[model samples]
Target: MPAVPGRLRAVCLAAAVAAVLTGCSSSDDGSGTGSGTGSGEPSVAETPRMTLTAGTELPLDAYERSEDDVYALAKAQNVLTEQCMKRYGLAYDAPDPSPPAHIRPNARIFGLVDAGEAARYGYGSVARTGPAPTKPKSAVLGETAKSVLFGPKTKKSGKALAEMPMSQTAAEKKKSGLVVNGSPVPVGGCLRESYLKLYAPTSSSVDIMYVFNLKGEAESRALSDSRVKKATKAWSACMKKAGYVTAAPASAARDLGFSGEAATGPGAVTAAKADVACKAEVNYAGIRFAVQSAYEKRSADRNAETLGLLREQAQDRLRLASQLTS
Candidate 1:
């Protein structure tokens, strides 16, 4: 899916989880949570703690951004627009980029402690690494083009145009009530018609809002969960020992002066590696992942009906995307 520029990244949802970290205890080995069932270090390890694996499809994660569908839909819209423009003896062109192979799940709490990530980007992975994604190219349609692609405006010249009411029937919907750019604009514009064909097939608004606010509810809980606080404190102390003082790995990565390409370079390799090492040493990933998962599970149970509908629409969109791409 095309990403809006300057979109805020995902944050920790650890605090949202309602489960208590009962079995956890601080281990002398520096891997424990420091408080739980007796002993210096926690007797039980991360294994006993609930953790999400790839085998699971958590509710929030199941709803994905169907990039392939979005790109294909965009192309379809462009083609439709081109045909519409040709009616006026004008040419239209749009460039659609291929979708990404896969988007990584949020790691706001995990902090890239994954062994593979540690071996690669190191501390650089602590923050979002690499440049922002490129948006697919599409012309900024002018009034005439907009009229051709969407619907005509009520006037030949204006800053805003009033939209005419739409009818349920296709033929009726095509009836024009307003003149835009000297052309009659229909109730339900052609552009919107094309969009409907590829997405929102059920005309369900839940499908729209589901993807729009995927993790809003659950993540908020996790961010404030006690488990998250404990994990962050431990991770912060570990980072301080490495000579970096930050509340979380995200904070370290967002320093601007020491992040991304700056810290990812060969010159800063050691620090990058150390960041990952500290993350593992303090078990930040384990703690946060478990806590967040608890919250997500709770949310899934509570919003089953709404989420189920959203999931169906999401799957429908995925199928449409596959058909278009194929």
Candidate 2:
């Protein structure tokens, strides 16, 4: 729910050697936003209320960064990190950042909406149902390069270097007191330094996760709203009529025992197609999306001041990222 699901958190920390990039990486919310590297889409807050569709931009979107923004920021970070590694006489070429394919950003937020997708991959995402992508070959790092790229292991604690606390500022890097290749390894090495440069430039920088937390809260509220519940019940009845018994669309895949490889089987595909049809018949997605948007509007209003600050910080980062990448 926190934009960056637990599964993608490792990708965020894997600053070095991200060879096979996909659609959404860090801060992915199963939902997509609009263009530009700035805050987000125009204020849907003032617009007249209308029936919402799958992948429709919500009001809180103004405070959120789009997937394009996340990728641009990541590429800039990679460029900066590679440049830092060059300073230490190590050759490093960071791969472009991307999210997994077939994930139509919020397409499945309430349940599958695309009939074609349901027929092909069933409950599984394209990334999971299709063949794995080939990983690009990267240069192997020697001990010296590894030590400089990722800080050396602690002597006393025997802690994994990757698990070490990372410094988010230059001052913190300096205080870490780590030296590699006749130079200071910024707290958690060049990766952490690149992160600090792009994300947390100052000690007082607001956390990037702040907006996502608010979005998640609103989504949670929308789930329990009476209108959404009513729609879900109608969808359930429709699915039952189609010979697929399930309590809710959200749990259909699990209830049907579809997991991993089984999700892509013919049986799953048939059920998935039926599931999507039922959702459409009952207007489930429209109802849930509308209710969720209303909740997001309320949350945005309550946190307007903080959201404004976060938006400004995001814009600043995007500007700097452009310069760094260019």
Candidate 3:
């Protein structure tokens, strides 16, 4: 999908450590309570603990866009980009912004949380759990359209553009001198222009990726946290008892040598089931979630001023998106 610069990059960075660590830095679990079950030892819940399923939002969710909102923003941006292209006498159709219904955004953020999903798909996707995906829009762009949608095709300019941040890229695009049919291509092309129109809008715009970057930082810290280490070690032992030899949940899929059809085969299903079972027994997800939350809370506290501005900007961006799409 054609996206604003940094959106997918930030998401990719966050997902890179998806199975390893994920969390918010706050102590509150969004429940009115001020604490969570982060203790190193496992304890029986007096009542049923809410299963940390794909639909469960982490504490950091407050600072980020929801999956539906993401799709809405992308669709709105597509409309704006197409309009911009029309002004330059170019045709542009951005890819569909719809996401799969069954697969929630946080599906694998904790990695293989659902035993039922594991039993059916193993390490494979939960595609079978959802409706057939919508056919994507054709994204073929003529060389002219490409240059206009993006920027100049010169190797030197391409190299420079690739390294520059979006803000700088937008500034440079003004003097790019790459005119199309007597019209100057907006900075970074129509794609970038549409992004700026909704997300940036001004030179002082707070980076949309700021909260995402902070979450990534928290995840990194949570990975090394003592509480997390203890819980994971217990999980590893639990896995070992179940005849799996993985040292950590993150490495379990890789350690079990399986590929292609074998990945979702009986053996894969068995191992995945064991992995999820061990995680539950050791309370791995809850512990890690808590640890990451604490880290994120500290990060958010330190950056409160910037985060406040970013939050306002994000809401305004959504309002503008609604206006554009409406």
Q: What is the C-alpha RMSD of each candidate to the true structure, in Å?
A: 9.4, 12.8, 8.9
Model 2 residue 206 lDDT? 71
TM-score for each candidate, following the candidate numbering = 0.64, 0.73, 0.77
Runs with alpha carbons beyond 4 Å of true place in candidate 2: 1-54, 99-105, 126-136, 155-174
Please write out the lDDT profile of model 1 over residues 222-259, one tens digit for every residue.
56665567667776777678787677666666642566
Q: Residue-wise lDDT of candidate 3 within 1-326, one digit each (tens)?
A: 00001110010001012243232332232333243233222211111122364665544567777656787898898998899899888777788776646456566776787888899999877774545568887788888898778866567645324332356345554555678899877656777777877777776788787777887877877787655676677778778788888877777888887567887999999999988877776667766655565555556556778877877888888888898888
| Per-model CA lDDT versus the true structure | 0.51, 0.64, 0.65
Arranged by TM-score with the best first, the candidates are 3, 2, 1
- Cα deviation of 31 in candidate 2 (Å)? 28
Worst lDDT 10-window in candidate 3: 1-10
Q: Per-residue error at 4 for model 2, in Å?
A: 22
lDDT (10s digit) by residue, model 2, range 1-326: 01211111111111111211112234422223221112321111111222224455666766667766877888899998998898887889886565434433565666677888888899997545323445755769997777667666677875544444423654463534556568776556778778877877786677778878887887887677655566677777777888888998778999989999999999999999998877666666655665566567656666778777777888899999899878
lDDT of 2 at 79: 91
